[model samples]
Target: MFEIGDKIVYPMHGAGTIKAIEEKELAGQTQEYYVINMKIGDMQVMIPASKIVSSCIRPITDIRALKQLIHNFHHGESDEVLPWKQRYKVNSEKIKTGEIQDCAEVVRDLLRMNKEKTLNSSEKKMLDHAYKFLNSELESIKGITDNQIKSFS
Candidate 1:
């Protein structure tokens, strides 16, 4: 369980801090919720304690994992050969997992594809979203500004 001030990444929504934990009544039940203040978009999200597991809320990654992710991006190659429809489905699933490594893979593959050729509009949008999600987490963990993030790419 996360305490107030703990940073966490909400799947597909980017990273945020636990600003407060509050009890509220909904559907004739009183339940505890984590009030997350998102780092991007000036947004806030309230996730229920009971649903935390299924909601895929997770703590920010450690430095070791971040280093490994950067290594993979620099040294790995993507073998995404599925048709566009199938590839989109798979990439979407990976991004939804909210795993930084998986999200990085999606961004790497999409960026690679873009270099080879222009991606369809949908794929471009997906790439942007995945990159934003991954970069937001990286910024929080690494304490880097947006300008510094580009140097990693």
Candidate 2:
């Protein structure tokens, strides 16, 4: 049960703040909904309160753990060399987890792959989306930025 102003990450959609909890009638049912204002896109999303658990919403990560993950990610390798199809599946799964650490790896791996060879259209789109998610989460974590961005550089 997140209160108003609680920061949360919606899988594949990045981090957002709970702006309001409103009740609306839909299909003759007055159910509570969470109104989330997304950080990066300046967008708002409304999710049903009852479905929050299955929706994979999670609280924003702590600065300390985020820093540790950034450090480890910077030193980690990204040369598994899987075929494109398999790689896409793996990355998709990570993004679906809504975990900042996993999102960081997807960003790092895709960036590495991009450097070695130009990514195909689909992978390019995926990288762009993944980067947005990664950056949005990074922005959500107060007083942290450059290290994570620097890792891909």
Question: Which candidate leads the pack in lDDT?
Answer: 1
The TM-score measured for candidate 1 stands at 0.92
lDDT of 1 by residue, 41-134 (tens): 8799998899999998999987667557777887888864889999999999999999988999999999889999999999999998999998
Instruction: Name every residue pair that clashes in candidate 1.
Output: none
Off by over 4 Å in 2: 145-153
Error of 1 at 60 (Å): 0.4
Every candidate's CA RMSD: 1.8, 1.7
User: TM-scores, in order shown?
Assistant: 0.92, 0.91
Per-residue error (Å), model 1, residue 148: 7.4
**lDDT of candidate 1?**
0.88
lDDT of 2 by residue, 70-105 (tens): 775778887489999999999999989999888888
Off by more than 4 A, model 1? 142-148
